[model samples]
Target chain A: MREAIILPTLSDTMETGRLVQWLKQVGDSVKKGDVLAEVETDKAVMDVEAFHDGYLAGPLSQADSDIPVGTVIGYISDSPEQAHEDQGSIPEKTTVAKGMPVGKTTTKELNQRDTSPVATAKQAVPDTDTSVPVSSQQSGIKASPYARGLARELGIELHQVSTASDGIIHAPQVLSAALAGPVPNLDAGPAYRYKLFTTMHKAVANNMIATLSTPTFRVSARLSFTPLKDLAHEQQQSVTLLLARACALCVQKHPHFNAVYTPRAMAMREQVDVGIAVDIPGGLVTPVLRDAARRPLDELNDDWRILRDKVKRNRLGPDDYQGATFYLSNLGVFEQVTHFDAIVPPGAAAILSLGAEQDGKVEFTLSCDHRVVFGADAARFLATLSQLLDNPKDSLCDAAKDQ
Target chain B: MVEQVYYWQALNRALDIELAADESVIVLGEDVGLFGGSYRVTDGLYAKYGEWRLRDTPISEGSFTGLAVGAAMVGLRPVVELMTINFALLALDPIINMAAKVPFMSGGQFPMPLVVRMPGGVAKQLAAQHSQRLEQTLMNVPGLRIAVPATPQDAYWQLRQAIRSDEPIIILEHELLYFSKGPLEVGLEAPPMHRAQVRREGTDLSIVTYSGMLDVSLRAAEQLTEKGIEAEVIDLRSLRPIDWDTCSASLEKTHRLLVVEEDSRFAGAGAEIAAGLTERCFFNLDAAPQRVAALELPIPFNASLEAASIPRIADIIAAAEKLCSP
Candidate 1:
């Protein structure tokens, strides 16, 4: 017995998932609850786990390509021999059984039925038998006039164009099929291959474009970071964690800084949740610390430790990284970054960027959505933050608690 | 410059304007001079223009319509009124043989400045006899022209345009649209009477309809917007000389076509639209052209069945959604 493995929907708005890599090879033994591969969604990389205990089968969908949701990525078979079937059939052929479901027509019979795509399409007409299935979901494929023309021009076969559109192929499906263009007849130019963009890269680009409508202004100042650095070293705590905790405290003191501007009214947030940016393999993510201002220092450190571990393994989910009242991005490790400005993400009033320490001072640039907070409010917020950073013994008490 | 008026009032205003302007223009039909026409389209013209210009005759469609055909053959421009299109069936002989072919058979010697006005489509419980839409019969004739105006503004513009033109024109008005009100700017410039108008612009599909089906198609297009299907509504104001250019241009962008009609499905107006567009826009289409028309059976006398027999707003929406579902 064999069960098909389909791509699962990871988010509310997700339409497709990119397969990053497969953890198990064909013919390899696999058990239930085992992660068979890693698939990347718009937000993060997620695990595609096996629900059935069997050997991973062949004809697995390739990696580094986006597959629509509910697509058959691979199969799990009960025997190794079944799992080792050659990868000759494309994904579309597997969707249709090639011939009419009449006493199991063989590949040789299907081959003899047609020498051209037009001929094969005509062969879908039922024979003189009375037992043909009533409305076999895919007994026939009907391509629109425009789609057929597109396929002909692009040198793609109609059967190879797969769509979720009942039994018809429209122009959109044909255009997507043409996405993998044939080798360019660049008869005079050098050979080059096109690589599609990953979901994470596209998500980041779209997120940046969304913030372009917000009116923003940046305020910069050199803050004393040596005291916080010494406090972190002496107490054995992460600098980024302490930074996130300090930003959360500052946000709590300046409630106006936590408000996001909306058309109806300015929304003042209740709890202080700080999102700290972390670099991942292909892109970056901002894992959030929920209730950072109200939670105890030891709990905050433990949450930060878990978030750091997830970032290391690239397994951040939406709950772990979304809807923060304030944001902290620390580039102090990249000593070359100094006095850089960041855009204020939607749903947040401001983002604070920290640069590497030079002459015992660190550059802190606060980028704010001007609709929520003014220049004076930003200046006051910065003054409060600098005062806390200068006197770390009084401010770093809970953040320095044992993790 | 724009005033809201009922469809019947728009027709009355057009007739009043033309009668006061031209002495050669005369009206002859039953009850038009004394009773002011069935749907009140010729209201008050009896008192203003008197019986000579707005003359009412007995209930003899064949003889009266043939009399207008002869009057148009000479110098006078005749505009004949049949209370409903069902009665026009008795006058098809003079309409098909005389009014449509005289100018051509005479080598352009006699200009057929004739306009025949009638109300059509199912209305209330008019039953099957009175509620007939035999446009396919009139449209099959070559020299004849059909103008199906949906709104009061178009009703005003097209009736005047049909009266001034030399060709034989049939102004087929819907029985239900007589009281339907729309803005009428009598002074505003009008497009060529036969040019199809795009009521709404969309990219998903094109809905080609005329007369009674125009308003229904527009409402269906509005509802389809909420379902994520943007449908373009094209009012084929003139059916015989269908403006294929406008429909073909829409198909160039949308790639899908849906024809809506109040007539039957077999060889009706929608059939010609789908077949004609298929021939011209075969490569541009993204799906087979579809139609939303009345059932092939005779329209039932029951009210609910009568309503169900023809294409409603919901029917057009469902057909459009299916075409663009891909």
Candidate 2:
């Protein structure tokens, strides 16, 4: 028996994985669970284990190429002699092409049959006329009689119906077309190849797109940043951490801001784990600070330092970055970003966007999910935040001392 | 009013009632008098109606079934009990040539009222010869009608209806269904013996089956319902001159059709159904009509192989799924 080793998906965002190297040479006898090769996925390098005990064979894909997720990488044959006989000649995954008759008239068996009309009819027909006239009509669409009548009743042309995965148009395919309103043909405009995206890039894209279904309204106020900035400079702390801490405290005052909108009911979280957006090369990440509302300042500083180092090295696992009840995005470092607003992800009630300090004030924009918090609640949240920023010295020092 | 009864007991009760009501009603077959019939369908009838009305004949099927036909020619309603349809092959000459053609040849002078009741289809380990279904053969005879009842209620209703009709009819029973139980309302009005019955109503696809396959198709319909495919189960109670109006009406509602039969697929009863319906309801079908029938081989003697050789519940479900799938 021979088994094909196909590339497997190693990460949620991995459309393609780059082959690192193969540990086994051609014709090497291997056992099940042996590491055959290493695959580089969207986030990390993972081992591909042998699923069956066999001799490794090639006509294999060369290492360092990004192959599609389900493409065949190599093969394992039953015997060593069979493995090395036809090197570099055997093909990859085989498929019955669409629209081909699935059972291509078993002529060899039909000829061996004692009686066959097909065998008898073969002697009477001429050989030159080869095209099957049945499939040639209606632009070569293969459909059933009832599906044709349904398309006529629905006022849809036969050629316009989308063929199902089996390459035949049926009632279900026609019904789905009736429900699909005005589909666009974007492939006619663009020429492109599938790209292997990093996990961080996928995270940002999906989270942003997911917020489109949420109804959001932004509230902006000019809050003084000098109080928080001076505290950061004097205590050797990060301004973003101090800002997240102050936002967590304000969330503690107004519990509605700590809630997320769910289909069943509002999920009011008990503790606020604030997420601070950080920029890295080629992508972005948000490493959460757990219990930011109750933790001490020095401990928060140490956790933030480690998270920053992990982000720089691209080592943030899902546990370190997921489940943040509130978010803070700072474009203050750019110093030229006049104003901006960040989208509130599904799990968070709101995200606060901060711009560069102009004079002594910073424009803070709060984007809230209206389903969880209304306009008046957001106004009160901003009022409390402005008060905390106006008195950051007492708020941060007294809160840290109490903890 | 209504009571639960086994399929064979219902046929026995119908026979007893018919014999008591008509002075011309007489029954004769091998073991039907002293042995109380092979499947107990004639149990206690010989003692109740006496030896004159119920006569046990010799083992020669062709001669005895011929004797019943000759008796019917003299204005008697003869219900001939053949042990099984496998043996009915020996009597086809008398059944097809005389019983079917005599009334037609006489042209309003003679009316033939004959009922041939026998159990057919794959029973546990009956093997090849004993388990053959020959409804298609009898259906081909021009002046004949065939009723295949699948339940006790239907067996009771259709057997009584078949005895009362003036035409020659064949009651094709399944060997496996003799002991199966259902409610029999004896006084319930009967539909025409040739009419089809919808055992279960659905909208996804129409399953036309008869005899032993009706229960199989109904079980398959239950499984298909859990898979979100609502299958309509139509029991084709009669085979000859099939109730095309009922089946076509079901096809108009559910444009997909699946025909299940215990006979072999090639040129079997299902072949006639799929072709005849495709011709009549061609514009109404959304998919090519499909069939679930016995494999084109002799019924196997081994237990599992015997079960696998004919249309099982799973086979019917899979065929219905494919017909309903895109």
Candidate 3:
């Protein structure tokens, strides 16, 4: 009878333990209580004692993989030859030991069955496998298409081009590999393309593109903020804060503007999670201020401060970036942007973009989703905002008196 | 209303009530069950709950702590008390990794409501081991709720809240404050978990501290008051899910800031508070935030040296004065 080593508790508290060093290797005879490996726990390193006496058969997980606990790290059997044969050189065999309990699968099972000897052989013996499949398209490594093109252009062997992401060749890898050669060609290739956005920017770009593609309408209005500026000067507060207060109040009244769009079922959400687009060095980022309609001006200011700092540091996590029913991107700081069309972020039904205050009046743009909002709703929203901003002194008083 | 009680008594009462209310609540530690705990906080607990709930384990903090982790996973709420935080080193695994990261790593599938209580900070001449204060260590550990109750009301409410929360919570009680008396109105209701409680209100400077240093902060506030310098004292009872709202509000009011902690000044919990405040309340600040903390050295056994090792009220007052100075 052969016994398989399955991870005892898949979701154990100590899921990933660092393998200090594997004491036993393939073909090594192990007895009960024999030292198999050392695992570093949170506190200290402890010896992992083997519970069964068997020959070690391993395509064992390497160190630093943060392997999920209860996943079979290796296999052990009574006979060395049988275990070796049963494992079929570690890469080709995919026969999961049967008769194990439900939810119990050995290391053999985790390996996907690849009847193609060439695939398994490639993993098992890199040199021999690469020599046989020089002309084959599949490199088994993941690299970008540009990288593969550059490699081919440079006459670099596909197997020698080690950098592949999920079998796709990435451009950077190919560029680096090309650089390693003597008198390497540095000029751009026909297949090469420049990246338009960084990782974070790409996410923002995708969402913005999706938003622009959606049915949307624009409404512009100029409100006299001469009173608001005077009020801010008297109250010793910023005009930006005054605008934020008015926006919050408007959100409370025209709750429909504070909504999310659902494309799957063609519905708009009711909850108001307001997103404030803070202009950082890398363009803009909108950190959502949850429940903005309910929170006071002071509270909103507090949230704004946190979000602004987060944007500056580029340390905004998913909680800060995700979820915004509506967006408020103010470009009033720039003297040139008196009025400009604003792009609505995905999930938000509308975005209120405030422009620079000029000639005793502040230009404002209200961008809304035509699928959910209308001209009448935009009019009400603008009216409320204008009222609040015009009497900025009242907004200051309300904030100061907030409990 | 269950009668109002002091923080120490309230904490003890909460333990009693919770243990009585649920069979899953079990207390385990050295000198906890039979000896009634070092501070006698567990006094009469063993007699009432019997050996099951108030079971005592060997001095093996590591293995027994691992046992508690297993017990918690198997539908039991174990309150593992370390006689002093110095001994927590022996159980750092179960506390830091298993108990804290389990819920988060499991993707909310399993939330271990385990509470680890320990007396941290310097009191007498207990030397380096016994007098070590690592509030910052717990603060640095993610996925765990760190509670440092400054007052009696917090003492009781935090423990109760920790029990109710679906996460790991560390209750760091200052050794010097086990018997300190303070007005505590308990039994009516409890405040929100992780919310910072304002101990005193002022407009000039904000004194932020937690656990044992809270006493010194309050005393410093009183001293500053006599000098005509109003200082607001905020007790950050919950370290993890920090009450940023309360701290931000106070900072907005009092531009000058000072943080006091029993931990060392170098990379202490005060650093995080100061850095966070600096980011959120940058424009509102007048003077850079100052931290009054223990000198960067191992706590000594000498009474005078130990006293000097931990932050004193005088240090806090001086820091506040310096911050307020034009």
Candidate 4:
């Protein structure tokens, strides 16, 4: 049997993944678990593994094209002849480069199995033929691929559909709107451009929206960074690394500060795994430093260096960025930024934001999940962290010696 | 209106109630009389019922089960408690061939009114032999009805119903759910003996499960709800005569089906349900039916491996999400 190689969801935040490159081409015999292609999700570029042993077949989705997760990009068959037979069934013209103008290929032109909106939307992108007006041919409504497919099948204008949730219309919403008589022309009077969200940006937007729903309060502290700066210079460690170390030490003293608040229970983590926010090209990523308080400063620096390289290369695994009890976002490297509060990720109880040093003092803003940490607990944690940063040499060297 | 009780206590209460209500009711199994059975399901029953009714048998499942069948034939309602479902294999011939067929073979002269109670499923590191789930095997038998009760309430009523039924029935219990507590209505009519119950109602998908898998499915449903997917959970109280009506009704509304079972995937109970539902509710389905079952391998002794081997909350959630996905 010929197995369709649907693009698997690489991450929770990934709705669609851009095919970066194909590792195996047509006529290539591939084994299960072999890297078939590299897909760039919002979080990272991941290798899509072959789930079956067969010769790779085409009418494959083009490289550098964004394919919705779960859409069939290609196939793998028992033999090259079988692969050719399968490819013959798939419309060759439907396999167009993403972002290029899609010609007029309706339901008849699509593969019977790939008749989803994701596949339809890829087919619906207007070609560069000037005869058809872009406005009439393309109603750029922010809707899911499945919704778009259903709208096309029903001959319902996407722009006229009313969504109950965020402006993005999903299939269920589209179905409901279609059921409730004729949809009103909601797209009139406004000439707004439909902006496509990158997977990473969408994740960040979703997280920020979710964080707003949580009961949170920010506590800012101005700490004298002269001691930490001097200690960092003497120890040849980065100030951000030193601050993370201090935060880790503070978490050890007050375990509640290193806790996650779910509706079920408050999980107090014994290990002070601190996630340090690193600014990547597209968005921010927090690579975790496991057992940060216990590890020596030099060892922590070594780990940080490796993680920084991985982040730069877009090779950080899920483990590298997930399960941080506490988060640290230091904007101290940028000279102009004075102080800014950081959004605490969903699972973590608190995030520590460090501002640029001015007059030998750095502003530290602690945003906590009020459900897990009370004002007093955050205050106590910040106070301990401040104290630790005030005398970094004595505390860090003493902790290292004790370890 | 109702009081909470542990799963084992509910079984004990049902046995106590049935023994007091009927003179012919008797309990027989290894350690059932003296030590109160392996998981203490028959705890304190020996003292109240005395040695005649609450008689303990030696370590011979086939002989004891055969004796229970014989007792049932001669106008006694015998409830035979096996230490675990793993040991029930020793008496499969008696259970399937004799106890299940005696009524039909004898031309309705004798009805096998017997209830075989046994705990099954992986608990801690019971290893391969001890952690077997043979509900699928027992369910395949023609005359034997299978009941897997997940909660204290179901355990209480279903056991009584099984004991009352003239047909031979197997009560498959989870050893891990022995201590879990739920409400048991004191004076209410027992639920139907051959129907499934919708534990949690939703519209996005139906998670059909029973036994300990019901808990896992409910937890998975809760997790799915957090992601905007409402999953209806169906607990198959009766496994043999599957309540296809309840399942089909839920599938008609949800249009998606995910069968979860702790038994191994191939030809397991979930496969049977999936196959049956696919046949009946083919037009109602929006997606192909998916199943989350224990991997097709022996349950390992290691804690982590054992945990990995069985269908878990995360596995159910993943399977349901895939089934619901467009």
- lDDT agreement with native, every candidate: 0.84, 0.84, 0.73, 0.83
* Ordering by DockQ: 1, 2, 4, 3
For candidate 1 chain B, the 10 contiguous residues with the lowest summed lDDT are B317-326
| TM-scores for every predicted model | 0.65, 0.68, 0.45, 0.50
Q: Which regions of candidate 1 fall more than 4 Å away from where they truly are?
A: A1-30, A33-230, A233-239, A246-273, A277-285, A290-299, A302-317, A324-403, B1-5, B33-35, B43-60, B183-190, B198-206, B225-232, B244-256, B275-288
Residue A55's lDDT in candidate 4: 91
Model 4 chain A poorest ten-residue lDDT run: A115-124
Per-residue lDDT of B269 in model 3: 90
The model with the greatest TM-score is 2
Which candidate ranks first by lDDT, i.e. highest? 1
Determine which window of 10 residues in candidate 2 chain A has minimal summed lDDT. Answer: A116-125
lDDT of 4 by residue, A1-403 (tens): 7788988876544566766667777878999988888776543456678999999987677766666677788899899887766443234335434554333334453333232212222122233344766566545656654566677787777655654324465667668667655743423333222234667778777777677767889998898989988988887888778878898999899898888887789888888999988888878888999899998877888998899899989998989998888999988889999999988898788999988999999898999999988999888988998788777888976796688
Colliding residue pairs in candidate 1: none
DockQ of 3: 0.00
Rank order (by lDDT, best first): 1, 2, 4, 3
Give stretches of model 3 more than 4 Å off. A1-403, B1-7
Q: TM-score for chain A of every candidate model?
A: 0.60, 0.62, 0.51, 0.59
User: Which residue ranges in model 2 land beyond 4 Å of their true spot?
Assistant: A1-183, A186-222, A246-344, A347-372, A393-403, B18-28, B51-78, B93-114, B139-145, B164-168, B185-210, B214-260, B272-292, B302-305, B311-326
- Clashing residue pairs found in predicted model 2: A146-B286
lDDT by residue (tens digit), candidate 1, B1-326: 89999999999999999998899899989999889998898999999989889989989999999999999989888899998999999999999999999999999999999999999999999899988898998999999999999999899999999999999999999999999999999999989999999999998999999998988999999999999999999999998899999999999989999999999999998889999999999999988899999998888999999999999988988898888776
Regarding DockQ, does 2 or 3 come out ahead? 2
- Candidate of highest DockQ: 1
